[model samples]
Target: MAEITTHQLVKEFPGGVRAVDGLDLTIADGEFFALLGPSGCGKTTLLRTIAGLEAATKGRLTIGDRDVTELPPGKRDVAMVFQDYALFPHMSVADNISYPLKIQRVPKSSRHATAAETADGLALHGLIDRRPGQLSGGQQQRVALARAVASNPTVFLFDEPLSNLDARLRLEARTFLKRLQRDLGVTTVFVTHDQAEALALADRIAIMKEGRIQQIGSPREVFARPANTFVASFVGSTPMNLHTATVSGEHVKVAGSSVPIPPSARSRVSDGDEVIWGARPEYLRWSTEPVEDSIEGSATIVENLGAAALVTVDAGGTLIQLVVDEDDEPEMGARGWVVPRIDRTLLFDGASGELILDDTPTSP
Candidate 1:
């Protein structure tokens, strides 16, 4: 296993489009790191650059202790699993898994033995004789993973390797993949647009936007304490509700209602500063009567999700959402109050969209 590092990495395409822009990152040895972002965010371009499939426009690329910026894909000591499971249609499972060994000029008997061992680990033992065309989608994905594992490369690169699977299969594959990666302890770099997949599979994730990294942290850190408004809105299961408000002493005025700012955020802005107040759906509590430090709103929609209900309220012109227990479902068209959990509230600078740090009491 090897650590991958990049410094000032850049990849610019024709028409003045920059896919990856001056990214500085490091993936530790045996670490499972994920690159997550929306479509056209340059995650795939960065992965391709790491695999030597795409040349970097400018920067240094290193694997372990060697500089590999100019090296070709074959010499990078990395194996990639593509989204489409790029397996040979005519090759049997065993043959496909052992193809890397063949290319390295290993003896046929040794290749078969290694293939068998890898196949058994991935539960593909009985499908050795089947070709890609005859295998199920999940089975084919396993074969692809088996092939990649059989190579025993220093690093594994996965470009949405489970995107094509059904929801159930995807969950299963995620669990299996995590176990497999743990067992092998090889450094892995995964690229995906799925936030849940990244959160579930990665030890650390780098969220990207417009070819630049927005935030890098553990899943819980990113989800619970987003660095800025973009991350606060992007990483949650339900997008965070953000509204423009004016700071007044220790409180902010939201839709003509005064809401106390969390003690943690008290010193971030002056009394007249305009800031964005953010709260996740789960952090908002609903009540029929006006409550302390709450904004009154009219419930416009109520969606009954099996375990919980989503209550969307219109507070003046701003829309807010609250996730409540099914037993506490609110009636649509009813006027109610939505109170944010002060401890969990977030404040962002309106002009810059940057998080406003509380710097007040040193500890929470």
Candidate 2:
């Protein structure tokens, strides 16, 4: 396995459309990194460039210690798994997995042995004689993975390899993929638009937008402390609620209620300055009785989600969402108050969408 590094990497299509723009990143050796973003965010383009399927417009790329910026796909020492499971329809499972060995001119007997070993590792030995058309979607995906493993390349590139599976199958495939990567310890890069999938499978994730990386961190870091409003709204299962509020001394006025700012964010804004207040749904609580730093509202919607329920409260003009216990369900149209956990609140600049950091205390 080898580490991948890119410096000022760029990929510009015709008509001056830049898919990947001036990205500088280093993925460590044997690391399972994921590139996550919405559609048309240059994630796929970046992956293709790394695999040598697309040439870089400008910059340097290194795999291990070699500069591979201008090398063709075949010379990159990389194996790619496509979203559609690009297997030969007529070839048997064994033949498909052994195709890469054949191209390298391995003896037929050795190729068979390697194919059998890889198949057994992936639990595909029993289906080796079946063609792609005769296998289930999950089985086909396993075959594709086995084929990638058979090559034993220095790097593995997956472009949404599990997108076609059903929900339950997707979960199973995710666990399987994670285990496979751990066992092989190969440097891998996965590209996907699914945030949950990235969070579940990657050791580190780079969130991208408009060809530029927005943030790179562990899943917990990005989820708990988002770098900005974009990340706050994008990374969570339920988007964080944001509202414009005016800083009043040590407090911010929200929906006519004065809420104290966390001590960590006290020095970031001056009195009367407009700031954006952000709180996650799970961090807010709903109650019928008045609570400290709470806003009164009428319940607009209540959704039961198995073990928990999501409550939406319309406070005058703004809508706030909070999670409640399933046993204590709130009735729609009931008047209630929503209280935010001040320690978990986030503040952002109203115009820039940048997070406001507290200044360090001066030593006396």
Candidate 3:
């Protein structure tokens, strides 16, 4: 496995649309990294660029110690799995797995042995004789992965490889993929628009917007201490509640109430400063009775989330959401008080939307 590095990498198309806008990145040897963002955010383009499928407009790219910026895909020593599992319809599973070895001109006997071995390692037993059209989606995906593994490349690149599977299979494949990567210790870079997948699979993630990375950190760091308003809003499964308010003495006035400044961030703002006060629904306390620093509100919407429910409260005109246990869910039109955990809130500059506190507070 090899580390991948890019310095000021840029990919521009006609009419000056820069799909990968001067990205600078490094993936440690054997690290599982993910490029996460919404569609058209250039994550797939970036992955393709790294694969040498889409040429970088400018900048240097290196795989391990080799300068692969100008190399062709075949010469880059990288294996890539596409979203559709791109297997040959006419080829049986064994042939599909051995295709890369065939391309490398390995002897027929050796290639088939390697293919059989790789297939077994991937749990593709009994299905080896079946053609792509005969195999299930998960099987085909494994075949694609087996083909990639047969190459024994320096790095692995995945382009939403699980997107085609059903939810259950996707979950199973996700677990399998993580284990496979751990067992192989291949330096892997995955691109996905699904934040949940990225959080679950990546050792570290780079959240991008408009082709530029907004933040790069471990899943927990990105989720708990987002670098700015955009990150706080983008990374969470439940969007953080963000409210525009003016700084008061150790508090922010919003929704006709004074919400305490997250304890560690209180000194970051002064009286009369404008800021965006934010809190995650899961970190909020909901009560029917009055609570200190509570925002008085009435439940306007309750969204079922399996064992929990998301209750959207209309406080004055601002809506704040809280994740309540299903049994504790307040009925629609019920008045409630929303209290943010004092140490779990965030403060961002109102004008720039940049996080203002250097020390992001954490729950005790």
**Top-TM-score structure, candidate number:** 3
Which of the two candidates, 1 or 2, achieves a greater TM-score against the reference?
1
**Stretches of candidate 2 exceeding 4 Å from the true structure:** 359-364
Clashing pairs in 3: none
| lDDT-best of 1 and 2 | 1
Model 2, position 159, has a per-residue lDDT of 97
Winner on TM-score (2 vs 3): 3
Better of 2 and 3 by lDDT: 3
TM-score, every prediction: 0.96, 0.96, 0.97
Q: What TM-score, to 2 decimals, does candidate 2 have?
A: 0.96
Model 3 residue runs over 4 Å out of place are 359-364
Residues 1-364 of candidate 1: C-alpha lDDT, one tens digit per residue? 4889999999999888999999999999999999999999999999999999999999999999989999999899999999999999989999999999999999999999999999998998788988899999998999999999999899999999889999999999999999999999999999988889999999999999999999998888787777889888888778898888899988999777889986667877898999998889999999998799999999999988889999999989788999988988888889989988998887889898887876543332
Please provide, for model 2 over 180-237, each residue's C-alpha lDDT reduced to its tens digit, 9 standing for 90 to 100: 9999999999999998998999999999999999989888777766778888888877
lDDT of 1 at 242: 85
Candidate 3 per-residue lDDT over residues 182-290, each given as its tens digit: 9999999999988899999999999999889999999998888788898899888999999998998978898899888877677678999988888999999889999
Sorted on TM-score, best first, the list reads: 3, 1, 2
Q: Indicate whether candidate 1 or candidate 3 has the larger TM-score.
A: 3
